[model samples]
Target: MKHLTVVDHPLVQHKLSHMRDVQTPSHQFRQLLRETSHLLAYEITRNLKSGTREIDTPMQQMEAPVLTGRRPALVSILRAGNGLLDGVLDLVPMARVGFVGLYRDEETLKPVQYYFKVPEQLDQRQVIVVDPMLATGHSAIATISLLKEAGAKDLRFLCLVAAPDGVAAMQDAHPDVPIVTAALDKGLNENGYIYPGLGDAGDRIFGTD
Candidate 1:
């Protein structure tokens, strides 16, 4: 799993357990997702470029580290992805935001792009593509392809839970892009849902269905 990263922090794991419970309400579910996204953002940005700048402290002058280069961009895959986006944005308030709306076709289980928008100069900035679930990977792959065509070079995929099938599909399609996820579950069940996975993230997050 060289391209895969499972965030196993105690706090993340604990929150994830709550999110998986069938009895958890939509409000609580969204809260847990936000809290968990904060942790995931921290892990994903651990290696972000930084530079030192001189600053005057209350006591004396000193040098402090600050993020370098253009602020990183967060591209939400839409609907469900927005859940993670809210939390990431809380941490990276200055990050350029983008949105790519893709819905899965029930018959084909393929991604259909209905909306797509991203910041300019994507090639010059690191981009984190966010979504709550990586089930079949078709949507992730299609979205990444779209980003690449639009000039995004450095990209990473973040998700709350992923199925092995989804991870494998992403690896096959975009091996260069690392995947950061909370849990890599057994695999997808028929109908393309991750097994032992928390139910549909969009419905849970938005109080729909």
Candidate 2:
């Protein structure tokens, strides 16, 4: 109950509602995911490092506050996380992208990394990790560790819906990092799925099943 951070922006709330509806088409669902990311990105990057520069407008020359350095990197958690990349990218089109593929190990109940590719010199840049469902948190927890090894010191975790258990795991393991989510559902089920969850994100988004 305490670990979740719900994003209550009207646009985010509206899109999240559509995202939960089963009738949403794959195309629309993907579109909504990207749009929601824009809203969520607003909250996560509210404190993005920026600098003021003197620039000339059509009318006159004045100091303007612009984003510092390049756009924040979008670090997708692979599979389902990709669904969120488009939404966030719509807001930060120039942001560099990265991917990490992790699957669960049944016996260990931990994330097993299959692949991870981050932008070069990520240590100097802020990173936003995107995954639609935060179910068990094993993947997010392990992914954060892996990201740190790759020199990602400044990181933010973003999810569409997070279970209480997953949020706790994330908060407990990575208290330094902030989590931004649209909805914080009740809890996880016996199969380690968030109750009333949107089901398998990758499958739902990609229509594989």
Candidate 3:
């Protein structure tokens, strides 16, 4: 899939192994997720545009390369997505933060939006959408649709882990948006959960269950 990128960095793979264990505690799980997110962020933004600007260092004045475009927007798919926001923010502290809160409707198995608040100039900057898991893909698709309706142009998706089904669905819906994920697990189970996946990211991250 040209739109997909699975990060195979040794650190990312190693931390993800620990994250999959049922025995990993909530605090430890959250810590590993944050660390992994930081690594993924590094790879996702590696090609960000840069331009030279004059600057005065402690010793001398010279032109140095710096990010040239408008600061990016980091849009977190709420609750679970918040788990990765800390690490991403650590890397891009100046990025505009946005939230899209969606919950699944049990009977319909569709995502319903409860909240959405994004930066004003979404059309002018690159937008990175963050979520811990890409499961059924409905939420991601809906969130991206909402952002586009609100005028977001460039967009990318970041996730801790994704299932093949979710990846397929996302690719079909938004072919131009690239997906950066730590691991691509087997297909989803009958219940729409990724098999061999870190169970219930929201619950695990918050110690809710």
* Predicted model with the maximum lDDT: 1
Order the candidate numbers by lDDT, best to worst: 1, 3, 2
Model 2 scores a TM of 0.93
- lDDT tens digits, residue span 163-199, model 1: 9899999999999999999999999877999989999
- lDDT string, candidate 3, 65-149, tens digits: 9997889999999899999998999999989999999997877768999999999988888999999899889999999999999
Q: Where's the lowest-lDDT run of ten residues in candidate 1?
A: 43-52
> Candidate 2: which pairs clash?
34-87
Pairs with backbone N, CA or C atoms under 3 Å apart (clashes), candidate 1: none
**lDDT (C-alpha, whole model) for all candidates:** 0.95, 0.86, 0.92
Task: Give the Cα error of residue 55 in candidate 3, in Å.
Answer: 2.0
TM-score head-to-head 1 vs 3, winner: 1
At residue 186, give the lDDT of candidate 3.
89
TM-scores for every candidate against the unseen true structure: 0.98, 0.93, 0.96
Candidate 2 lDDT, tens digit per residue, 1-209?
Answer: 44346898888888878878888878888888888888887887776889999999999999999889756788999899988888788788888999999987777767888998889888888998999989999999988888888888898999999988888888898888889899998888777888787777887789877
Where model 1 places Cα greater than 4 Å from the true spot, the runs are none
> Which is the better candidate, 2 or 3, if ranked by lDDT?
3
